[model samples]
Each structure stands twice: as C-alpha cells, then as structure tokens.
Target: MKSSYLRASAALACAVVLTACGGDDGQLLLSGTISGVTKPGMILTNNGGSDFEVPVPANGTGLTRFIFPNRISSDDKYDVRVKSTPTNVQECKLFQNTGRAGFDVTTIEIVCTFKTQALGGTVSNLKNDLILVNGSDRVIVPAGATAFTMARVAQDAPYGVSILANPAGQSCTVANGVGTMGPADVNNVTVTCAP
Candidate 1:
C-alpha cells in the first residue's frame, strides 16, 4: 500500500510540473465541433481511439467549450465520439461546439441533407458552407440553412479533448459563435481534423 501511495504521489507531482512548464507557449484555446449523424448523444474520450468521458458543458447541442492545460502534449489529444444515428436509411449528423473563440468551429452544423454519393449517400449544403465529411460527397451547408438542426452534435466540445483528420484538403473549420472562457484562462492547444 505504501508503495502504491508513493507511486501515485510521484505521478501527480509529475503532472503538476508538466502543467506549469507547458504554459510557456502562452494561453491557447482549442475549439471545434463533433457531429453525430450515425448516432444520438455524444461522448468525449481522452484516448486517441475510444474509451472514457471528459468534462462537458451543462447544455449540450453537440456544442461544447472548455480549457486545456497550457501545453497540449501528445497526452492532450482527445477523441470526440457520438451515438447520433438516423432512424432509417436516411442520413443523419451531429455537431460538437468547441467553446473557444477563433477556433476550428464555434459550432458544428450537421444534417441528413438527403443522400449523395458515398457511404450509401451524403448530406449536401443545407446552409451554404462547404464541409463534407464521412464517406459522403457533398458540401457542408451554412448555418441557418434548412436542415441545420440535424447538423450539430453538441453545443460545445468536451473538456480536455482534441482531434485530427487526414486528406489535407479535407479540414474542419470553426462554425461561428461566442466563447465562454477568457483568453488568458486557456493556452497551447490544437484542434485538428480527426479520422
């Protein structure tokens, strides 16, 4: 038991030291959106794959906002997943709102948009923006467009989380909205498109 206690103490001490030293880059906030077109409700995990829940906001709309330690080391990359599936063969989508200003997406707008070409079909521009993910081949609609509600996953992102994606041309963008925390309160975070 004593050995276990000592190990735990040492681990915590390391975390603190890392947190402090990581702040040098200044405060950077990570923000973005997660969509649930295949499922309803979302879950945030620290692991790059899947497993575990990070902190979330009070009211969820696929939108979320939170602070990250000054340094977003390899350990900070978090995976955001959701269970917002469609009822039938119809298309579905959900969004995650990372509550950081000037970040990837202030709010993510997801939707069914009917079917297009890939993954059985795709969701087209219900709004106006040009964002197409999943196996679908359609442009993302802008906010306030028809079928916009179906596009969001959460109001904000889960706390202490981040993601990345591939296909350089295909990148995630911060929708648009106000952030909650003050700039100084956060730091050194990255929000990349995830696979």
Candidate 2:
C-alpha cells in the first residue's frame, strides 16, 4: 500500500512539473513592410545575423511586405537594418526597425529612392546661341559655352540628346549623344560646329 501511494505521488509531481514548463516558448516573429523597390538585391539582417534577401514582387505589387527567419523572446532588444539596396535605387531606409521584442513586431517600414544621374558633355566651337534637347527637356547653351548639361535622368533610363536649334551662321552636330543613362554622369558627347 505504501509503494502504490509513493508511485501516485511521483506521478502527481511529474504532472506539476510538466504543467509549469508549458509549450509557450515566448518567441515572437519579426517582419516589416516595404515599398518603392524598383529592383531586386535588397538584403536585410537582424542583430548582425539571420541575413535574408527581400525579393522584388513578381505580382507587380512592389513588395508590400517581408519577414525575418529569426524570432526573439519577449523584451529582448532587436536591431534590424538594410544590408544592401536594390539596383537603380539610391538607398533604402528603415523606420521603426529597432525596439524591444515584446510582441510580434510587424510595423517596420522600408522606403527606397531611385538613383539619378546628370546628362552632360563637352561642347566646342559653340560661337552662337544653341538649343539642345533630350526628349522634352531642353538646355540653351549661350555663345562660347564649352559644356552643357540637360536634365538629370534616372538610372537605367533611356536618353537621346539632339540639337533642337542650331546656331546662326554655324552648323553643329552631336556625336555619342544617344544612349542609355548609366550609373555615372555622361560627359563623352562631342559637338563640333562648322562655318
């Protein structure tokens, strides 16, 4: 009878311990929302670990969200940051990315901006007022001007520079003036005028 009582007592003790250590690990998932992601290659990190890349949405929604693979415990300090930005984007900034992991934090925001490059080149023998144009954008180069710049163009965009109006008493032509705008400024265009 005493052995049976001790066995029952041991079972009760095991139940109590199991109840105390429940299934609640208390880890929370971390995620964020993103917008203006024009190109792929956006990589994110959490506490300098758990690196992951946020791909550009193929559904054409522009990547409305993302999630981290790692989880954090309640009240644990967390730091999330962008490791790299997409191509054609100047930078990606994170908002509300740092805080204590008290709950499932999903309000983090990421915004990105496109990179722009200036379209300019050297001009020689420009003795009279001249008008240059790239699409609707125009630039009026005064007499004796050695160089000119159109308007800034977004990276990976197409640009075709041409002469809107030639100078009086002179005929000028543009060389290497038609191409796409790269990541750097274009300054190789040459314009030579003949009398």
Candidate 3:
C-alpha cells in the first residue's frame, strides 16, 4: 500500500510540472502599417522596449506591414511608437501616436512628406534695388542693403531674383539663383549689382 501511494504522489508531481511548463494563454499580437518610407528598415518599439526593425521592399514595390516581435499579455499596458524613422529624404509623422494594447490592435498609420529647407542668402555690391521672387511672394532689398533672407522655402521648388526697380544705374546679376531648392538651406545665393 505504501508503494502504491508513493507512485501516486510521483504521478501528481509530474502532472504539476507539466502544467507549469505549459504555454501562456494571455499573449496577444500587435501590428500596423507604415507609409512614406523611402528607404528600408524602419524601427518600432513598445513602451520603450526593444526595437523591431521593419523590412523594406525592393524598388517599385509597395510598403509592407509592421509586426511586433513578442506577444503581450492583456494585463500589460503598451504604448506603441516609432523607435527610429526611415533613412530616406522625407520627414515622417505618426498618426494615432499612442494606444493601449487591450486586444489585437492594428490600425496605426505613419505618413511622410518631403522635407523642406530654407532659402536665404546675402546681397553684395548692391547699388540698386532688387526683388527676390519665390512663387507669388516678393521681398524688396534696398539699394544700399547688404544682406537678405528668405525662409521656409519648399524642397525642390523653383526660385528667382530680378530687378524690381533699379534706379541707381546699376545692373544686378544673380550668382546662385534660379534653381530648385535642395534638402538644405540655400544660403549661398548672392545677388551682385554693378554700375
């Protein structure tokens, strides 16, 4: 009878170990989509956890879905966010910045826009007035003015400078003008005037 009781106790211990090693039932998945990623390998995080790098498709291919690495429990709170942006030449913004992981949520989106740069520069050898033209906006630099600045110019936008009213018998010529603005500030644009 003692041997039979020992065997039953061992069987009970083995059952308890198997139950302890079973998979958890509380794990939930999280996923979403991303747009405006020109380059590949964007990263995302969960409540400051480890980053999950996103895969980029080949050229001419469309973007792919982003999924988290580990499953989260229902009791844990998650704030999904971008860990790092794409290495492309665009500026990305995230919609639905923060959300809770109560269930399997997958409605997050990221949109990106072409980054803008400043268009500005100094005026030198100016003996007459001139106007810098960007779209329909214009800025007049006085005859004796030595410097000028234009800000918030859109990327890849065309710009030019011309003599609005040259009354000082001086002809103005632009050195670094009449070109599409790049990703950085165009501060080297010089308008030189001479008699």
Q: Name the best candidate (by TM-score).
A: 2
Q: After superposing candidate 3, which stretches have Cα over 4 Å from the reference?
A: 1-41, 48-50, 54-77, 86-97, 101-104, 109-118, 125-128, 134-138, 153-171, 178-186
TM-score for each candidate, following the candidate numbering: 0.21, 0.63, 0.50
**Best by lDDT, which number?**
2
Give the Å shift of residue 192 in candidate 2: 4.5
lDDT of candidate 1 at residue 156, scale 0 to 100? 21
lDDT of 3 by residue, 90-162 (tens): 6667776466667876777766555667777777777767777666667888778887876566555567755
RMSD in angstroms between candidate 3 and the native structure over all alpha carbons: 7.2
Collision count of model 1 = 59
What local lDDT score does residue 174 receive in model 2, on the 0 to 100 scale? 96
lDDT of 1 by residue, 53-141 (tens): 32434454433343332322332433333333333113445455222333332243334332221111122232324333322223343
CA deviation > 4 Å runs, candidate 2 = 1-29, 57-64, 69-78, 86-90, 100-106, 114-118, 125-127, 135-137, 152-154, 164-172, 192-195
What is the alpha-carbon lDDT for the whole of candidate 3? Answer: 0.69
What would the TM-score be for candidate 1 when compared with the true structure? Answer: 0.21
